[model samples]
Target chain A: MFRERLAQDAARIQKQFDLVLGALSDVDVTQAMSYATQGGKRLRGFLVLESARMHQVDIDRAIWPATGIEALHAYSLVHDDLPCMDDDDLRRGRPTVHMKWDEGTAVLAGDALHTLAFELCTRPEVGTADIRADLALTLAQASGAQGMVLGQALDIAAETAASPLTLSEITRLQAGKTGALIEWSAGAGARLAQADPAPLRQYAQALGLAFQIADDILDVEGDAEKAGKRLQKDARAGKATFVSLLGLDAAKARASELVDEACAALTGYGASAETLKDAARFVISRDS
Target chain B: MFRERLAQDAARIQKQFDLVLGALSDVDVTQAMSYATQGGKRLRGFLVLESARMHQVDIDRAIWPATGIEALHAYSLVHDDLPCMDDDDLRRGRPTVHMKWDEGTAVLAGDALHTLAFELCTRPEVGTADIRADLALTLAQASGAQGMVLGQALDIAAETAASPLTLSEITRLQAGKTGALIEWSAGAGARLAQADPAPLRQYAQALGLAFQIADDILDVEGDAEKAGKRLQKDARAGKATFVSLLGLDAAKARASELVDEACAALTGYGASAETLKDAARFVISRDS
Candidate 1:
């Protein structure tokens, strides 16, 4: 029954996202926008919706925030693929926006997506100005150089250094680069649902760390066909990874332990949080 | 007396900008942020103070909004200097952020600056949340692709294309690329001053256009030494130019006419608008 409900919510939210993406299409910007938005796992959106459900918020009220998170996630991917950044030519079996058009267009498209996220969140009719402002601030903190931007900076810096990262360093990098946004997605949904901040933040922190470990493990062992992109690029890049440092099996075990902690963190929220609990399970269980 | 007041205002605002810029210094992101913010005319900052002066608003109340606009303006310049965009190697006699640091640093620095703008505007002590939100939306609209971003896209597209652009096309490009932020800076100050939207927007639009025309004229005739950067590069690149289309003298004359129209638009606001009127004259009269 929970699975069915999750599917229903996903479908409904995906349709709303389609409308959001469709409306963004302009003659000059449409192609880049389509490339950025299409074929993502929609993991961030799921986090927003599922977390909102945990607080008994209706999916309709959660959809805009969900879309906002997805837009930000997509934009990060777009910039991450730039020649000077991760330099990946392909994403999800398609040419990246930079590869399809030019780096300038990709950069601008990413920028537009970032602005669009804030714009969508601030839509006055959807939520109170305070809620919108809080969400905007939360997302900005997660996405800016102090968060994801700083992570990317560290990643780039790591490329030139010969020093091996300790576990703490690796976790710090992942927390900023990957975990920040994931945490923000959950936190934003909770904010939209008007949940208590203390427990919600605790839950998000654990889930975010678990999510990154899962991603690191997937990069090591996940199938290319299922993952829809090149696998093992992380190892190839000489970048620090949980699987590389902790060993694959240990990384998998750590992810499971983190997920358990994440589930435990949500206990006070009651049965409404079952989807988020399942999401934690899904984060570690997925091959992709 | 007016010149002294304007100078004092500029110094005071620059001090505040220095504080904001100084906060980023300890972080690795400082180089790019410094590169982007340290120099330039502070025209947007000027507009912010001048607009507030029209309503006899406290300079302290106006400082945050001015800083916000400057932040936005700095981010735009950083992104504009990226290789995929303007590819500018030098700005203000120094290498641009992208040229000085790597492109990734430049990108992150721009993103951080953009977010910082909102952060400054939304400081709880600065104003009410409603005012902060309004300022953020106004600045975002001006900076986003639909406004400045789209203008830049068109500017770039026109640069590489074989098609001849009409004066209307040039006007549209300038309005978006350069004019939108100018308009926002003016309007945001007016908003802070609690001026009615009608007269404020009218003055803003005209001033914005006049500002662009003056910039175009300066690019043609100004000395590189005085401008603090290379001149004639625009012509060398065969980029669209008002001087190229209208002849050097005609462009200069048109810029002066725009100043007149811009100042005339402020007539409804009374003698208190003298700073803004002087700003318009400065726009057309200055060598740079």
Candidate 2:
């Protein structure tokens, strides 16, 4: 069920991106944006659409935040692929933005996509003005200095640090890096509906950690071709990750436990949240 | 008189920057954000506050977008100074963010500041939700692919082009690169008041063009010590600019004429808009 929904959401989100960016005169940047945003699992968008459905919100309003999160996520990936950062040549099975065009284009395209995220949230079709403002504000909190960027900074800092990060430290870093946006996407529907976001927030917190644990496991044992990007980089750099810190078996067990906890948090929504349950389960099981 | 008001506005705006960024936990990025934002002319910020004042808007609400524009502008400068971009070492007489910190921090700090711009605009203190959404939406329009980023991309493309840009090409580039933000800042007050932004748009279009023409003039004749960053970069690269397209004498005359036109657009505001008139005149006259 979640697989079909995820594919549909991805197509719908891509169409919305086309509608938002198709008219831009900077075809190179917009084209790069489309490429970067394409082929993601659309887990964030699915989380947004499903959460909105659970809240009885319209798909029209939900698509705004859904697409916004994906754009924001895509921008992060583009920047992270820069020479000074991840320095990766391939992403999503193709040349990264910097590799395809140039570093300057990648930077500008990433910045433009980042700006587009907020623009989408502010669309009148999203919801009331207040809800739009809330979406923009929360997005800033999730993606800014204290959130995703902070996590990136910490990750960078670890490269030169005298010692590897402990389990707790890596947890905090992953919470900021991978968890913040997931939590925001999951809670966006409740924000639009002016309902309590607590349950979704709890579910997302566990799901995000589980997602990262699964990623660490993949980096340890998954196929490089299936991943479509660099893997086992933590081992290459002698960096500590969940798999390194917890052992592969322990990491897998922890991920399974977190998925259970994530689903348990959705008890109030009953069967309506089963897709989200599937999503949480899929996060741990996805090969890529 | 305008100098003193501009100085006060810069100081007040800087204080707001401190307030907004101080609460952030990522000290390194926040520090870089502050350093990049400091000691500039604050011309864009002053336009926002002065325009808001012209609309009889309170300073409390006005400062949000005022500071927001400055943050957005600062982010552009930070990224533009990167090694993959302009590769500048100095900005505002201080080492660039990448020089002071590292490329990773510079990238994250710029991203954070860009996010902060929208976050500030969404402040409840700024105005009604509709107004805040308008600010965010317009800001995205002014700064995204078809606006500032588009301009930067063109400028980058110009570096390797077989031929120099024509006068009209440079004009279109400058309009997107510099004119868009100035137009947005100058028209912000009217947006907040739900007034027609037409006159300020006309005024800013002329002012922004005039401002770039003056910058070209400065690159030819101004003191680098006063400018605080590299000057004559266009000439050094053999690139076409306003002064190259038009003779020095003709360019100066054209800028002065633009100042007059920009001032004339404010006839609807009477004496209340004298500061803006002074700003138009100052854009061409200032050394930095």
Using lDDT as the measure, the top candidate is 2
TM-score of chain A of each: 0.93, 0.98
lDDT, candidate 1, B166-186, per-residue tens = 789989888888888888877
lDDT of candidate 1 over A1-288, digit per residue (tens):
445655666576668767765764264555686568776677777778777776677777778878777777878889888888888887888888998898989888887777767766666644666676677667777777568877777777777778867789888888888888888877776688566666666777888888888888888878988887888898888878888899988888898898888889888878877877887788788777
Residue-level lDDT tens digits of model 2 in A1-288: 989999999999998888877888755777788888888788888889999999999998899889989999999999999998889999988999999998988998899999999988888899888889888988888888878888887888888889999999999889889899999999998998989999999999999999999999999899999999888988999999999899999999999999999999999999999999999999998999
Residue B81 local lDDT, model 2: 97
* Model 2 agreement with the true structure over B1-288: per-residue lDDT tens digits: 689999999999999998987787755777888888888988888988988888889999999889999999999999999999999999989899999999988998999899989989998899898899889989998999889998988898888889999999999999999999999999998998999999999999999999999999999999999999899998999999999999899999999999999999999999998989988898999998
Off by over 4 Å in 1: A1-25, A56-58, A193-195, B1-10, B56-58, B193-195
TM-score of 2: 0.98
For candidate 1, the lDDT comes to: 0.76
lDDT of 2 at B178: 98
- How accurately is candidate 1 docked according to DockQ? 0.49
Considering the two chains of model 1, state its CAPRI-style docking category. Answer: medium
State the displacement of the C-alpha of residue A126, model 1, in Å, after optimal TM-score superposition: 2.6
lDDT for position B220 in model 2:
96
Give the alpha-carbon lDDT of every model: 0.76, 0.91
**Best candidate (score: TM-score):** 2
